[model samples]
Target chain A: MTTLLVVLLLAIGVYCVAVLEAWIASGRFRLMAPACSAIALLGRESIVPRKPDLLFFEMGPIVLLVAALLAAAVIPLSPDLIITDLATGALFLNAALAYVLVALIMAGWGPNGAYAMIGGWRFLGQLIAYAMLVVMPITAVAMRAESLATTDIVISQSGLWNIFYQPLGFVLFFIAAMGLAFLPPFDLPTAKGELAGGVEAEYSGVRLAVFRLGRMVLVVTLAAATVTFYLGGWQGPSLPPWLWSAIKILLVTAAMLLIGRYVPRIREAHLLAWCWKFGIPLALLNIFIVGILLVVIP
Target chain B: MITAQAIFIGFFGVAAVWFGVVVFRTFSMVRSAIALLFSQTALGAMFLTMQAEFLGVLQIMMMATEMSIMAFFMVMFMMDPGGMGKMEMTHQKRLSWIVGLASFVGAVAIAVFIDWGPVATTVAETAEQTEALGLELLGRSMLIFEMAGVTILTAMIAATSVAIPPMPSPEKTHKDKV
Candidate 1:
């Protein structure tokens, strides 16, 4: 069935990214390193911390993974390959992804450790920075399409993708997507040197794997959404729509990882200031421009 | 066979009630906040079952963000935030119970007795429904909607200004002191 294939592709996409990340982290860009790492991890014992809130600690990673999958469900792999084509698919994706914040907080707070607590609260700061960055551009895109449905947004790009039109919006969205996924420069919540893995300090073995995998899935979902909302979901010439979707998602993921590796980690305070002072105002201006263009042209 | 909508409504209805109870019963402030989120999420799912997709998703997203913030604030302020001591959080035990039960009974009575308006004979498709709602808001209620948005924006700015901690005053130099 189409649904099963969509799920399979999503899983594989996340796996590929996770592998790529491990390769980067281990100082080796070998292809088989991630698989070997996974095999080794399978034998490790899952550890639960003492004096921790067990319920929330256990629920966190599962919820994060569920949220990622739920967000991905709304994305159309191709014209006929969507899991659920809700009228408000775009909004639903946003809503589902918002819960990732909750899961991160739960993970951070439940561990009852200084590093975990600090990491958890750091994500809140990250959310404050990137939340509007994600929403404003999506709103502008919806305005251009005059519809909230992902399918409709894609259709409006039959001639030209919104990326060409909403260049500023695309740039803002790209940065925020990375931030939301906690990739690279925005990975303050789990900064290894400073917080000793931050929200992930206490997690070990299977739970750790689940949490790490979920984070990768979050990256994959964000990339897929970028392709869906901006690059035009499954719209391409001289190739199958599903293949096009795959290619776009992979390209976006690679770009995020590449940018993440090259960029130095940003200070939390500086990032927050950048978001509030520069990002928010620019996003607002982009919206104003988009509205003017829409009215003037349409 | 039972319809999928009916099944989903039943599931979410029970989940909403269960989590609502959990919200008050939980000893930990963080747990209580998350329980409240679950309760809201279940209600949102119920709305989805009723085909109010936009409202459903809005409810889920808003509650998730709000509850995440609430949980953070609770941890920052509340003592024994992890509930290590398992402290009881309830107050006004007997009087509050009586008041709650009485309010619940009154709400049920009102719900059962009210002569609600007749339901629509037919419902529009999802796209048409959303389009119509959008038009209604932007076309007729445009002024009020925009005003409300502006009001919220102003409130946000005010809150941010108040919330940001004051910067430390510069220390006076010996020359300035002299």
Candidate 2:
């Protein structure tokens, strides 16, 4: 069963990569067609500039791909089907995500373009801003779950999903995750109008294809994590367990993509300020509320 | 199910060989920095496998981000983009190699000398682990930690704004100079 689950995860990862490649190449996924056309109409071209170093450009996608695979090893598909099942599953997930900064820096520096370099620095700034906010909410959730294992967190929500009790934390976490994932409104580092392709302006061909694929896979992975940690993964009735899990995951992914496509972008500094101000405070408030509820409600 | 010890052993073996190759084959400072970042990531993974959850997260957050930033700085400051130039691997290299070998030997020696014994079973099962963690986090201490985190963030933002270099005046334009 564990072997089957691992294989299934790998297959899904590969499928996500393929879909993203197809989308980037044709700029016309069934769901993303409108956004692609709008972007096209805006006169955005995916150009690869001259004399870019190949190694750095190529490494971005490779690192992202490897991170996704390693992250999968820690997620549980069923009761007994995790590859690693470390006691510190939350830590493992965060650790896996830390690879993104490295990949982004490599992509930015590898291209040897001024815009890409600036984008890279901006991304680092974004990382510092969002990471602090993201950690608090996730850590709050982890503490509320009492154990770090993915399955353990899901089971704790057997009585109630954390979102019901900690909506503020959920919202803060969702926004921070969106920023980290470079979703719409928060994708300042990659804002096409101002920074060309942001960190990836000089990349083309298979390199661009791989990075695009990695982005999609990361989207799916982050959505799955949000579900697993907060929305009660595979806990619904009237369906097989795995199917229920799939439904929840798809719903989150759809919501993420919808937001990514439709929302207007915010300036990088403003976005950081928003996170530091509203996001962090709300996350802290939720933690306090949860603590009070735990003490008084029983 | 593999024991933590076995996992540690496997990771140590792989990491040893990986770092060995990195030290031998890396020709430039930038490549060495990148190699160090990857090695640190591997170490963080090993820490997770060892069930040191907090430490693992800290390791990943600090090491990975710092190493990447170092790599970026090296590229920006150094003239060579590819880092293909010859590097000085002198007395520091020998010291590092000796220290690494000694550490490896010391670790193996400790593992061999320690007595093997039965360990107490964990109270939380795999399924219950996440729930227990959630419940634990709901304690009052976590709230205090969260508050401290916010305060620290505020200070950081304030410092950042103060440190940024101000934009130059428009009077120093090319037209005026001409």
Candidate maximizing TM-score: 1
Best candidate, lDDT: 1
Highest DockQ model number:
1
**DockQ of prediction 2:** 0.35
CAPRI band for model 1: medium
**Model 2 spans with C-alpha error above 4 angstroms:** A1-54, B1-32, B45-57, B72-178
Taking the tens digit of each residue's C-alpha lDDT, what string does model 1 give over A102-167? Answer: 899889878788898899889988886798899889999998998888898898888778899889
Q: What residue pairs are clashing in model 1? A: none
lDDT at residue B164 of model 1 (Cα atoms): 100
Write model 2 residue lDDT over B35-118, tens digit each, in one string: 787677677667556655556566876787787667667666766535556654456887898998999899989999998787
Question: Which residue runs does candidate 1 get wrong by more than 4 Å?
Answer: B1-7, B161-178
